[model samples]
Target: MLITLIILVLAAIFFMNGKIRSDLVALCALILLLVFQILTPEEALSGFSNPIVIMMIGLFVVGGAIFQTGLAKMISNKMLKLAGKSELRLFILLMAVTSAIGAFVSNTGTVALLLPIAVSLAASFHMNPSRLLMPIAFASSMGGMMTLIGTPPNLVIQNTLTEAGFQPLEFFSFLPVGLICVGVGTLVLIPLSKYFLSKTGTKEKQRGYKNKSLNDLAAEYQLGDHLFRMHVAPHSPLIGKTAAEADIRNRYDLNILEIRRITVPQSRFFKTISQRTAPNTVLLPDDLLYVMGDFDKVQHFAETYRLELLDTHMPEERSAINRNSLDFYDIGIAEIVLMPTSGLINRTIGESGFRDKYHVNILGIRRKREYILNNLKGEKMHSGDVLLVQGSWNAIGHLSQENSDWVVLGQPLNEAAKVTLDYKAPLAGVIMLLMIMAMVFDFIPIAPVTAIMIAAVLMVLTGCFRNVEAAYKTINWESIVLIAAMLPMSMALEKTGVSEYISNSLVSGLGVYGPIVLLAGIYFTTSLLTMFISNTATAVLLAPIALQSAIQIGTSPYPFLFAVTVGASMCFASPFSTPPNALVMPAGQYTFMDYIKVGLPLQILIGIVMILTLPLLFPF
Candidate 1:
């Protein structure tokens, strides 16, 4: 027990220091417990198969789909209209909507979906996003208190009750408490956020360089004038020939960007197919080749190959091919700056074999302020020259990893996220609704974990996410491992008689004052511990003790358990107390003092409210 206590204290110190990852710290503590024979291997590894852990993983995928399909963003955008131009209205609506979304989605994901929107809205109102962002982060946590699967701490308490042979909580058991939390939070945060946050503006200089949009890069290179499309005519010499066989770049100085083929299915609807212009890619009859070159060279190539030139000078066509054409679903463009130490600094684009080596076509080059568009194959590469390259999004992403050669500007993958699967929004919405119904209704016969698994799989199979790997990327392994590692500590505490010891001390100290005061003691203690460690970890450690304390005092454990969960979640005085709080720190230009000034008051106020309200809701 002494060793276990020492390990726990060391883990708390490491978690609070934040120099190392919290997950790593927890795992170390778990290993210490195992090494000391405090827990057997089976006991140590049981958390991996815990239903709470499985459910949390599933929820991450479900919430990721909701974000990827733009469903959450669309909902929030529509709701913002109700706020009009009133700052007070926007503040209230932001809290309400964020909390509402946070109930269904992970608080981290809820903040991610709403962060940019909040910033944009604040910009529109001529206000700093700092005023709205911190409050939004806090509201996300408040929102998580509303649902059983909304937050990890909620799941911890629920799992504790189930293992204790108590009546399991219903889906909406936390709803009233969640409502009170949001109410109290909203009331307390309004003036606090306005006064503290409005005084600080976003530190744009600290954010580093903001990458330009694809359209901006295209315009600067004047790529539209150099880009042309040619349709393969009958008996064309280019028919059935691969790009390598035709040697188009050498013969005509024209670079083929991609091949677009159209086919009419049995439904008689024409479907357009776009493929990257690989060396061995075969040219089919009637294929439309998108190429870049001087107008004269493009015309010359068309005449030489018996292909018909298609006019793209119309406003709609030009706009479509420029703005809407590269939807980044597959093919995309990005700028890469050549390094001074690059091996190909003095080599021409053709001599460097960029197309053969990287499988991407260099459309244009920017040397200092000069834009070189035509005959790019012969344009010698220079240090600090920015090349506008177009290829498969995957190819562009590969360029980013070549740090020794050049720096791929902006985030290529993040740019792809902007191109959402909006078509799947309704399908994702339906899947979510069905999952919620299954969890909420007693007749469904589906366990909550089963419901979440079904929704996560459906999100992937139904194209709510891009693919399987994309789905996997949504799960936060750190948090999952952290919670899994910390769960065994709770069992350890119970088995070693630490839970009884702590509960006895708590009860002996506060039992005479009535259950209300004892409940407050548990609530405040959990909240205080959470300020230093993860809330989920705090809940796992303290939940068993809270239950034992209630049992020893001869009162219902529900209110005591409720205090544990609520206290664990309502932490806000420190930035690192919760992921949502840390997520908004840099964007909000907030310092440690900012969180202390704004979040401390709200945290105490909500703790007091929950202490007064939990007993009424659950009965002592």
Candidate 2:
């Protein structure tokens, strides 16, 4: 018993430190228990095959099917249209929609789908992303409390009850409490969040390049001054010469951005079209040279080379010229940051052959506090250096797939952004609804696990998901392994009399103050522990103890179990407590203190509501 307690305490400390991954910590504790002969190998590994774990795996696939079908994107578009230009309406709508979606899907997955939408909305409204994202994260957690499969902790609570010879909770058993929490919580959070979250004034300097125009992009990176246009003359020395052969940078001290050559098709009567240019592109008479150089140097070079200079008259014309130069349908500009583990680090751009390999133009590089726009061919690439790249969208898509090499920043908000919804959306929706109906009505005469597993399989068989492999990848293995590994700790507690001892101690001390005090104590303790550890792990550890305490106090265990469920799901006080919180932190530009400022108060309010409401419903 003493050894078990010591290991659990050490595990809690490691979990709070955040240096080690939570799954690794849970696995280490499981290994220690096995090494000390505290649990047999079968008992320690039983969590791996638990029905609850299997259901979570199935639910992940189901959620992925919905996401891949672009249902979330479709919903986001409609919500934005409904909210219009009102920030308050947008905020309320986003929170309500995200929460509702989260009740039926993985909260982390739901947040990931909606984050880009939230970021785009913030950019459009000139509001801080943090102001919107924090509430979204909190609402997602509240939404999970609405259904059994909304989160892993709810299932874990039900599993504990079944193990103790009690009837498991029904699928929609948590709906009433969940609705109350989500409704009241949103009412409190909508007004209070503005005070807690940072207000980044009008899009003076948004984090990424999502909503900026071509001219805005150029000015931000200081590329506006160097761009110029020159026309190649009929008798120019550069005519009939390829860009590489001419060596424009060496001969005229200018970098060629593009060459606008008019091509005449054999069948065309009068149409003249522009073609994409490359280093091997041959120059012709009347071809426009978009070059980067000093105005005086460009003028002198034009005179020396017998070329005609194109004067910049209107900014609108210049913007049009710039926009028309790039084939927006096929090409785009993106900002990509080199990750620390990138293999391209320490190599100069010239040596890396990035242009030849990736078929993208490296416009400039931002290293540390400085932007390196000149002499970039020899500039060595470093981890964390941001590169502005222009290329075909296909090439950019390929580059974005290599996450280990670079982190692609905001994709251009314009262009044919990847379609989030497909024709399979209706089919996916139907499958999800059928599964819900089966669980709610017990139509299948089988366990909820069987119904969920069948729905997951149908997701792929019906073509909602791309393939079986894609579905498999959607399951969060770390979460599965962590929950499975932690289950043995609960079993060990019971076998060692640790659960009984703790329950007796709680009942003897807190029971004198009546069941309401005891319920508050259990709820508060679970909520507090959840702030620093995995909520699922907290529920697994405390559920059995709460059940034991209820039995010792001679009352129905329903209220205590329900309290544990609510407390475990209320992990809002800290970002590290849940995956959804961590997922939105960077996009929102939030700090540790930001979560505390908003989440702590919200957690307290929700906890009070749960304490006041659970006993009345369950009659403890």
Candidate 3:
């Protein structure tokens, strides 16, 4: 009893403050549970090896590969164009597409793919992106509940059912209820989405943030006053001044990166010097000087030295401008921005083989403020690091073909790579065949994990992920660690008889209401908890309770199991409910109230559906 209270309190506190990393919090709790003898060490570590856990992790990598290729972007774009006239039609179209994709692929991946597209579509209609983004996210969640592989909850419940001597469910088993949820959910979306939040920005910024957090990675590069980039242009009085007079280094908190004379060619590639160039060197038109230091201090020095009088300019690294190593029959060069949720994050360049396999070459990589060489320095990469890759002409052939894990920062390059532009369509078709064959007539059981892994490599072999190592350089380690550590906590819940106790207590107290109501209560409790804690942890902690409660009430466990699943996945109440929420928080400039206004009603709608509709479909 005491242990339960302590664990619950610890979880509540952790969820309330988003300061610590989820994985770290999970690890701490796991250790605490073990120390208190609440769970064995083996139980704590068991989640790492769970088939479901392994499948999810492996699938994440595959999803990353597809996203990196830019295949999903094209598809979403087409949907936006096709939804021409009506706002309702557009909302339905986006939601339907996301739901369809989520049913077959990863839910989070589906959201990541559609977020920007939804935002773009909303902007086209002159609507606030926040309105549409929440729907896309909600729709993705609803869509995921339709298939066996649609969501982790479905998979968890299915596995639990099988363990209890029930036959395993088919892939589309949840489709029946799934369709109903979509139908009802989509209807609610028209009103909740349109009227709920501020309507000025697009969903792209609402669901995902445009600005990257510098604090997470700036510390890694040691961003002191050395080797900085200060924007200056042509015709400045300081253009011909000596370094000593510019006072940029000694007086200003900085060091000079390089001095360019006429063209900006080699200037983009920084060159640091201890000694200043001779005054007689005569600074030419548009000479860019790179200096590092505090932005404020740099500004002060520029103001005092009148550096702006020379011409300060911003540096642009467009994807189309990035060069490639060799010719891809239909490829082009591009610099792709990696989103934090992308699967390609936290991977190694050598392992991804984007170069050797896909015929693409990485020119440079950037994360927050840390910029590494396109090829070598970024060989060890992390999430949010922009990778400059040269793609073949078929880069824009199809959403799936150009599917990738990175964000397209600008338009695709026209002359970046050898123009196989016409041939690009065929490559896309080939990729489609490969992906479909892998997912459907699986003579080799090509699940999402296998299908995507094979496709990612084939992309390289076929020159899609031109730089094989790029794939390896793109995974998010923090998420992986979190998933790995939480599994054991889930296992311990079942092993320690704690799940039974909690379930029994809750059920006994609610006996007057009966089994289904009791189960619903349990699920709602979990859903509410998830708005604060890690949704994964919520699922892990409550999953056992759901099962045990159903047994205690002598009802079928499937309904109860699914109730918990849906509840755990519905993280619409608070910003902390999901990583996606945080990603878009600043871009929308959303206050906590904004999320509540938008997410609260969606939560209620989903809650009613889960409680009333889910049971009829899954059966107890």
Q: How accurate locally, in lDDT, is each candidate? A: 0.79, 0.74, 0.57
Q: Residue by residue across 256-359, what tens digits does model 1's lDDT show?
A: 88786543322211113445568788887877777888889889989989998887653223111222233455677888899999998999998987788888
What are the runs in model 1 whose C-alpha is more than 4 Å off? Answer: 58-76, 83-91, 101-177, 191-213, 229-253, 261-273, 283-288, 295-324, 334-352, 377-386, 394-445, 451-475, 508-511, 514-600, 611-620
The per-candidate count of clashes, in order, stands at: 0, 1, 74
Root-mean-square deviation of Cα positions for candidate 3 versus the true structure, in angstroms:
17.7
Q: Which candidate is the best by TM-score?
A: 1
Model 2 lDDT vs. the true structure? 0.74
* Best prediction by lDDT: 1
Which window of 10 residues has the lowest lDDT sum in candidate 2? 315-324
* RMSD of candidates 1 onward, in order: 6.2, 11.6, 17.7
Task: Look at candidate 3 and tell me the lDDT of residue 81.
Answer: 71
Higher-ranked by TM-score: 1 or 2: 1
Q: Can you give the TM-score per candidate against the true fold? A: 0.71, 0.53, 0.52
Q: Arrange candidates by lDDT, descending.
A: 1, 2, 3
